[model samples]
Target chain A: MIEIKDLHKSYKMGSNSLHVLKGINFNVEDGELVAIMGSSGSGKSTLLNILGMLDEADSGTYVLDGIPIKNLNETKAANYRNKFLGFIFQSFNLINYKTALENVALPLYYQKMPRKQRQEKAMKYLEQVGLKEWSHHLPSELSGGQKQRVAIARAMVAEPKVLLADELTGALDSKTSYEVMELIQNINDQGNTILVVTHEPDIAQMCKRIVHLKDGVIVKDEKVKQVRAKVNV
Target chain B: MFNRDRWKEILEVLTTNWFRTVLTAFGVFWGILILIILLSAGKGLENGIRADFGDIATNTMFMWTRSTTKAHMGLPIGRNFNYKTEDVETLWEKFPQLRFISPRNQLGGFGGNNNVIRGLKTGAYNVYGDYPEIIQQEPMAITAGRFINQSDIENKRKVAVIGLGVKNELYEAGEEILGSYIKIQGVNFLVVGTYKKRSGNGNGEEGQKEIYVPFTSFSQAFNRGNNVGWMAITAKDEFPITSLKMGIVNEMKRVHKIHPEDTRAIGFFDLYEEFNRVESLFGAMSFIGYFVGILVLLSGIIGVSNIMLIVVKERTKEIGIRRALGEDPWSIRKQILLESIFLTIISGMAGIVVGALFIYGVNALLDANGPVDMFMNPSVNLGVVSAALFILIISGLLAGFIPAQSAIKVRPIDALRTE
Candidate 1:
């Protein structure tokens, strides 16, 4: 579950202040699959960054699982991010030097898991992503689709309550994009709370709910029939 | 801190850039080597010079009579003087601190023409008349037979201890010279021993060219009266030889009736003072060696610091990623610090091992060859090695500190945006 009310964010460019997120109110209930859709300058990316706690909002009252996420120190904020949220970046963001298995194990390492258990847990997640055979390969050696799958496995390995996908298929071809979307659909079917941020209408149609933003404000919120990803290719 | 994974990561990073690491460590390596070598070489020089003075015991003094500069009692200012045999007894009675005093008389070379000798062969050579106590002051190795004893002095026996060089000149090599009579100045004296000086200048061979005989025989045979050419004196262990030397100088001035202010009258040489001067000079030299060594090592440490700074800069992206993964700032700092410590220890230890081997080679070479003037076995001191290890640790910490601080300051957002 996630709750946000009157969230505000701004950036200073030279002497001018650019308002990125303005007076936004939004909520997502438990186990819901949602898409936040917006074109460039619609503040969708800014909202995702705020939700991921990677950036501080100027003014916000955000609650996740009944805990207020405000005025937390760096350690507390990092702990919360580790325990409750996961991120899938458009660029995959896998450390180039580490193998896919090691990348998946990284979050568990931060959690202070023992090496043997961490390795086993990381392998299970790689298996779930259908990448068990390719777990030892580095990101550079992996295809775009495989790298994104590894990143998704990494995001899921920590067992966080909410998964945030930020244009996860932006760098892939349409067929690979559909395959990744199919994976996301399967994950949502297992009752995980997820938010997909994208500008693509077809990507939005794959989610059970969609929220549209225009000029730093949400313009539409509606539920839709989810389309299954055809994996014929 | 004891995690194996942390060490693994550090090893990976270092091995990735091993060539650069070695280049960075070279300055420090060379610094440690040069420091240890210079210090050991300086010690070797001091050891060699001290070896030359070993025959002259630390607690000994040599007093030879010189002309008085001022009138005292009935003696005139330029009055030439020679000590008599009675003067030795008188000096020993005057100074109870006197441990062993030998009234020495010499013939040939030092005062006049060398005596012509006849034995297995014939040659001219210097001869010395000394009491048995002279052996305690400046020792010579007796090769064959024995030195002149107390009975030789009491009976005024014509017994001689010929030097090795004298033996070589007057007799065939490996021939039996002991108990064979050698005629000196037409007086036949039985060869009692053959001797060689242990250490000295102008080559130790010079001392091996002389001969030793009992004082009474030398005085009686040469018709030199009761005159003593010079005296060698040593004090007991508990006494300060310098004070005794000054007392003797004053006493000699009183007996010879020379002015107390006339320093040249007695012509005394206090070996203890000379030894001290040489010791202090070596002390100062070692101090300078360490001072210069530290300066060189400091520059090497700075070089390490500069390289570490570059390494930190290059890893900004990796550091950011770690930060984003919930890694603590201290962990980043620790990683960088450990890498630096590893580099310093590895390189510094290599230098020490190489330096020790080099010193070993030098010492072996010196041992195989004879001791050279002002130099002997060169080797590193244990204290110097301990000091070098301490310096290495401090250098490691000093080099790592700034770079570690820079590494921990990386924010995830800015680092992620770097690409």
Candidate 2:
């Protein structure tokens, strides 16, 4: 479902070029739950942003669902983000002015969904995330766990081909974090491709597979066994 | 988010930040207020000056002989030329533009000292004979009875209209002297109507201390042999009073068989020149008032721009978040732009409504009291309101466009990363 070949990103800080992402090659198939784990400065967040179409790689070949992502312009890339991509951020990234329901329905704005149907779809996704009762509350009015839940709901509402969770449970307590992971695992089981970036070993263990990155390169790839492995498989 | 949704967002921004919004609105509100008030005052002053000229048609040109030191046709320098009735008729006959050029024959104290009214009235009155057409050329809208009619002139009747000052001395009230009899110079004459004296007034020249009698009657009764009264000539309105006076002077020379160099023999007051001078003064005053109003309004608009710049700066983080949420640059631009337009419109409407109400209150008061006694009907002009409203809308758009475009240029990544 995704491919990256010779991807490169550089920054010019005053005098010289600092290459952040060296040329690399990677791939992940459909219905796969892949976790990319690395220490700080490993470019895990930058890779997730590039995959989610939020930022551009300086030199790279990125193919997503058979579409070559590099040749797409800004407007087209934004359109692709609307139709095939969704994001879950560490800080939630929900608009503070909006209620949880409206925040979740935001992606539907790009699809031109009429307001009533958008709200209904947003409500269903909030229910799926077990936050149906808190769907009308603003981000500021919600606790850390509730805010992440709403963000998860927003990510799931569009039913995109790929869900990129960037430190989705980083801001939650362990109990709430476990609850959120279980919800994400359930979402993966429902047949959507999932990618998560995290620094925690336990968080990586929750996924079916883990790719270890070091210094912007993939150092190791391993298949993991979960506590409730294949329970419903 | 075009109209309804855009406005909804604007209302949220405004209601959530009411104090900031009101501060912005105040600038526009006061601007419109000053504009409307100054304009209304300008209109009032203009009307007052016009009324100062009074109801007697000052625009009518007179060809009364001005006494001169020079003589014509080699006559002695000290000799005076009298404009006779024959000369007045011959001049009028030749010039078709002479609407009414009749000799102003007076029957001063013709009723014998006005003692007929006993000691109730003073002897400060005169019975002046005028052609029936003379009053029509003037601005006197008769309050009750008609002016001197052709029949009164042909029959030399003793009927007359009393001045407001004469009415005060005789009948002592309004709309009542239409039937009262007044003894002018000891002769009993019926008052056909009472002329309204222009308000806040003094001096008899403005239709006070006088009575109007038919020129034909007064001429027969009081004009002696070879007695040619002053020529009370009025030009047709289509003709300039100056040109008409010149035309009449040329024709009078032809009739009197005098040379063109005898310009000193004739004297006249050109009311058109007087009207232009006064009108130009009023025009300058109106222009200055508008100039000041616009200057203040421009400052107010600049103030609005300053405050909006501050608002954009204060909301940088909020704007960055909105931009990153997949909202287009246009949406950001539109949101801030709508906020500004809403602020300006709200404040402008408030100012205009309040200022209009104030002016309306004054107009009502003035109407109840009557048009400016010296100036007629100095009230609010709907034209001025329309002009002001147009300026307000243009100012609204002008003051909002630049700051909002600046908002659109703010990069989301830069804004979000700004510590």
**Interface RMSD after interface superposition, each candidate:** 1.9, 2.9
- Give the Cα RMSD of candidate 2: 5.0
Taking all chains together, the TM-score of candidate 1 against the true structure is 0.78
RMSD to the native, candidate 1? Answer: 5.1
Docking class of 2: acceptable
RMSD of each: 5.1, 5.0
Error of 2 at B357 (Å): 4.3
Q: What overall lDDT goes with each candidate model?
A: 0.85, 0.74
DockQ score of each predicted structure, in the order shown: 0.33, 0.23
DockQ of 1: 0.33
Off by over 4 Å in 2: A1-5, A24-32, A50-84, A109-112, A159-161, A208-233, B1-4, B50-60, B67-126, B140-145, B156-158, B167-193, B201-206, B224-273, B298-300, B360-382
| Residue runs of model 1 more than 4 Å from their true location after superposition | A1-9, A17-37, A41-53, A57-85, A161-165, A185-197, A204-233, B17-111, B115-139, B146-160, B181-190, B198-200, B212-262, B270-304, B349-378, B381-386
lDDT tens per residue, model 1, B320-414: 66666666677778889988887887888888899889989998888888767789777667888998999898888989999998887766667
- Candidate 2 lDDT over A1-233, as tens digits, reads 99999888877888997777787688899998999999988988778878877678888789999988876554465567767887787878777777899888877865667878989999999998888998878889999988888888888877889999988888887777887888888888899899999998878888989998888788898888864423322
Worst 10 residues of 1 chain A by lDDT: A72-81
